[model samples]
Target: MGTFKIEGGHQLKGSIQPQGAKNEALQILCAVLLTPEKVTINNIPDIVDVNKLIKLLEKLGVKIEKLSKSTYTFQADEVNLQYLESDQFKIDGRGLRGSIMIVGPLLARFGKGYIPKPGGDKIGRRRLDTHFEGLIKLGAKFGYSREEQFYGVEAKKLKGTYMLLEEASVTGTANIVMAAVLAEGQTTIYNAACEPYLQQLCKMLNRMGAKISGVGSNMLIIEGVDSLGGTEHTMLPDMIEIGSWIGLAAMTKSELTITNVSWNDLGIIPSVFRKLGITVEKRNDDIYIPAHTDGYEIQSFIDGSILTIADAPWPGFTPDLLSIILVVATQARGSVLIHQKMFESRLFFVDKLIDMGAKIILCDPHRATVIGHDFKSTLKATTMTSPDIRAGVSLLIAALSAKGTSTIMNIEQIDRGYENIDERLRAIGAKIERLD
Candidate 1:
């Protein structure tokens, strides 16, 4: 286990190029199993989750060629479906929630799929019933063993049908889309998670000859095709990383420019941040944050009261970014309520922030009120361990803006998504060191 010792109270200033989207990359990598042709992916992030997924692919006999630091060519010419049942494969599957997506492509191609219980942030009880229910709706049968905590699905000639997911689960939507792309008929998925990550998956599948309509909406129409061919695709820039950078710049009063950001894809994120008085400038695809931004008042409704930022389905603010938004709100000028309805346990991390001199009201398991300090950076650093990916990054941001040094343990959680985080922070004048 490694730790990050960070000296706080430093204004970060530099330009950073955002890496590929971790969520999109994971699904895209699994999409390779749909075809045997060469699938080249560019702008891949060197993150732990992606590395683990790649190792899983290699174990299943996918020939992966490293073309460069951020590029790779994947060919699943001889995929051994039985390898997915191995204990080693099951262990690797525990590293990420996206690992369950492999079940779709494998089942579509090989007529069967097996996956251990997927592991990710312990934010709440993430149910896979929606995923299995969608697959079963499309002519697939599933069986699970509670002792082994393993799931298995088998199907022959999947026939597409209308699927209205109980909730807009991102991975569930992606799995169904991947499965439906090669099914026998049209599949209509209502109330799907049409986030940018899922949109990227749909677009990439289209490029590979899958007919998918309603790319960025809650309803998706996928026309099942007989076969899917391989194609080269580049992953989108990490929007969560970009959002984190925005929070860091605001907290530290730094002027940072984030490059390669898809400005248009940031739906509701900009408006939500604007409520916190954060100004974001878009120069083409790049975002620039000015230094010494005097934090503005929290905007309320027509009645002039406290406003809230909450998570919803796609086009709404992402649930994964609620932690960063909450932390950033701590440095703003006024109070704003953050509601994380998707995950029950996500708001527990706010207790740590309250301990760090942040005025936070934990309304319940799903909501909190954050009162900003308005440039009064009086936080005293403390020792803390990372809880999850988003919360871990939020803690790092708070630690970096504190008055003293802070030690963060179990940084592997942080490494699961953000690529070269310490090095990137160092380039922007953050004093963070990795200690073993």
Candidate 2:
């Protein structure tokens, strides 16, 4: 129920560091359950969702030692199997979507995995079919209670088999990979999610003695091992946050440098902004965005069609970032289409931007065409409510570039993903204050 009061039209300067990848931390933290030895993880983002997941792990009897704010050692030597059947377990497990991932490692190590239906951002229908089907393919007996909305899987022992996932779901792939690593035989997963998060998970697993090949491709080959050892891992910088900063700098006419961005891992994100006529300079492990004082312009296709920015799988634009792109485009020159194909309701936040005097056409649930303001006009600030994590940051960016003062409520949504966003932005000369 907190709010952000922002006085817009401030020129931000200096550099900021991107937080650890939220998606990757979710997978990497859960992977700690695969071994009983000490697994040390560094660069963990201190966000709400991640902290909830960590609390769930602590409740499961995982010995957690906080070596530092961003580093921890996890030893899952004595998991409380009885707790899985407790009502408290159901309540704790349902806090975040990443809670569902614990099922894979638990099923692999303890032969039983249980979870109540998880909760997360209400962007669209995020189904668990891929996770369920993939586990079932590995010889686990699956059961669901429709009345209670519970899911459980058990197996005497898992036997590896090839699974062609219906979709390259990121969490689904991570869950299955964790399960297959301890199964009896070889497992080949085709059409898998090869995002940098998954790649890091695979690499960590390999270091822990799992035989996994194809680290950065869609096809994964894993040969099950009897036991896995513990290892140390560091998370990559959050690419989505990096992209958000780029958009923020352009919209607010700021010069911001984001450090340790893992440029090789940010696939097509910088180029996507370039399509919006934003200047992105790669400095080794960082990305520098210069102020767009001359005005940012949208680039059309060679055939003279309006450019369309849409979300696809890994190498494609992430659905999480389309909202940021949409807000940044509001101040650019020319018109472009923002297509959010994966999620149904993610594009609805554009209505708020429209109320702020940005010309936007919400064509449908999935698409919105934005006509840029071309710097001749500035958005008039207004009170608004944040819809979700990504959209909340998008609105904050809009407020930063608007002509007057604005207040955004329900910034808890923003807090779930970005770490100390208001404080971080304030350090870079943004006029933002957090009100409780």
Top-TM-score structure, candidate number: 2
- Looking at model 2, residue 142 earns an lDDT score of 98
Per-residue lDDT of candidate 2, residues 1-436 (tens digit): 8999999999999999999999999999999889999999999999999999999999999999999999999999998999999999989988898999999999999999999999989898999999999999999999999998999999999999998999999999999999999999999999999998999999999999999999889999999999999999999999999999999999999999999899999999999999999999999898999878899889999999999999999988899999999999998999999889998989988889999999999999999999998988999999999989999999999999999999999999999999999999999999999999
Q: What is candidate 1's lDDT per residue for 1-436, written digit by digit as tens? A: 9899999999999899888999999899999999988999999999999998998899899999999999999999899877777888778787778899999999888888889999988899999988899999999989998998989999987998997889998999999899999999899999999898899999999999999999999999999998889999988899899999988888888999999898878788777777788888888889898885666557787798898899998788899899999998887888898999999999998878888899899999999999888867667799998989999999999999999999999999999989989999998799999999
Q: What is the TM-score (0 to 1) of candidate 1?
A: 0.98
For every candidate in turn, the CA RMSD to the true structure comes to: 1.1, 0.7
Clashes of each: 0, 0
Candidate 1: list runs displaced more than 4 Å.
none
The global C-alpha lDDT for each of the candidates, from Candidate 1 onward, is 0.90, 0.95
Candidate 2 minimal-lDDT segment of 10 residues: 284-293
Q: Lowest summed lDDT over 10 consecutive residues: which window, candidate 1?
A: 292-301
Clash count, candidate 1: 0
Scored by lDDT, model 2 comes in at 0.95
